[model samples]
Target: MSTVGKRGASSPRELTRIKDRLSFIYLERCVVHREDNAITATDADGITHIPSATIGTLLLGPGTKVTHQAMSVLGETGAGVIWVGERGVRFYAGGRGLTRSSALVEAQAMAWANRRTRLKVARDMYRMRFPGDDPSGRTRQELLSMEGRRLKECYRRESARTGVPWRRREYSPDDFTAGDAPNQAITAAAQCMYGIAHSVVAALGCSPGLGFIHSGHERSFVLDIADLYKTDVAIPVAFDTVAESEIDVATRTRRNLRDRINSTRLLDRCVNDIKELLDHTEDDDLNDQVLLETDGDIRLDSGRNYGDELSW
Candidate 1:
């Protein structure tokens, strides 16, 4: 008795690439249902149709009710589905990745497995965040020290630029309302960035837990990726939003961040940066192949029995 029974899930080639899709769509107080390939959100205003493949991340905020058929279409189209708190400042859960290939994940694991490569990748991350500063030959502790200084400098600079009053960064994870306007906006922006980064990381088939600089958390890599753009995108957007008006700071910050992300093509940059960081050269047709591991670091096509070729 499902509408989705008639249509098969979309092939990788059929779905829009993650980089080409919209940054994210935040929905609330609506009933989401499937209509053909698109998902429809019906609220008091009216029913709005959104093409499933066009979304990079679908943030279902508090009071959003999504149907099974809607989820099916979203999954088929490779859209990242996230459940979040009001105004999307808190994350509750996330859906699966888009990619069927293991190439990028394999490369990530290969890089993470070794100490030298992991350190190099960590330094590279810092280098990306701190342009004009060579992180080369720096120890992890030195990199951390540099990052701390740069972060403080970023806060000071943004405060001066936007004229938003800033003390130290203070956040209470248990209570969102505990922070001031600027702090609240910064937290909201950071949460949004995490969702966005998680979407890209998942789409690329990389392990979210395996991180270069951060460790032990399930979303360690997601945090690492999100921080790469925090100073450049989130912090500025948050400060600017607060400077304009303190009212509805989180909502305004989300809107401004979305616009900035789209205009700056952050999604495309995010994808490219991940590939570059992992030192991966992904084939265009990686999604099309199902490969099996063979002896001596080779791959064989999957789905055929190899027992006949292997003599007992």
Candidate 2:
């Protein structure tokens, strides 16, 4: 008997909420294929089954083959699928989001379209990242300067805590191994955090390019979201990972970071933070529905033809 077919595609109401799903699932050197509603990863050891709906992001690392059916199930469940290099250090592509409502993305665009609103959102983001340090009335340049100083302090603090040698942040795009062990761990942790942020952004149907603070890049908003946890989560985790063992710093950082994110329930926090930042509330009327704009900012129900003779 063939085990190919299952229930029909999941409706928006049937999809899992982004906050409830796992932060991410990483697989490498394996073949991924669908079995019923679940996906199976086959490797030299054995086959492991994973429920598609539980995954927030599926990170396909190096040496992975995904069958069409696997992708199909993943899409149906609204999981973000990202292709990355070893240990998810390099990003290449990402899958679409699971949300059927355009409320969040629309709110994001509206906020981003205004200069003052954009700056306000940026300040709010900084405030969220560093609570007790008010960003109110701070110029953008001042915010950047403050962020740089805070980061330097974070690196120093983590280094002192973990007994890892403190050094200025350094990275080489051409080579991943050029950095010291702590630097490698930090870079790896940063990349993994980016993947998690991208997953949350995609799952919530938010635009990755409409960034408030960071800009001019496809994943600008992604960077902004990821940076929120850098000082507290990523930096600390990187130092701890390197301190624990210098061997395989990148891979170790990914594992430790994943655990920390899950333990901290960062995905739930991320979804909530994005919603709060965008000032978005889910509208049941807009879920899985499309509307057309009229001349006076009226919303017309879709699927009905307005006669051409109707004037604006």
Best by lDDT: 1
lDDT of 1 by residue, 76-107 (tens): 88899999997788889999878888888989
For candidate 2, write residues 80-147 as lDDT tens digits: 99999966789999998887777788899999999999999999999999897999999999999999
**Whole-model lDDT per candidate:** 0.91, 0.88
TM-score of each: 0.96, 0.94
Clashes of each: 0, 0
Q: Which portions of model 2 miss their true places by more than 4 Å?
A: 1-7, 283-286, 308-312
List the lowest-lDDT window of 10 residues for candidate 1.
Answer: 281-290
> For model 2, how many clashes?
0
TM-score between candidate 1 and the true structure: 0.96
- In terms of TM-score, the best-performing candidate is 1
lDDT for position 71 in model 2: 91
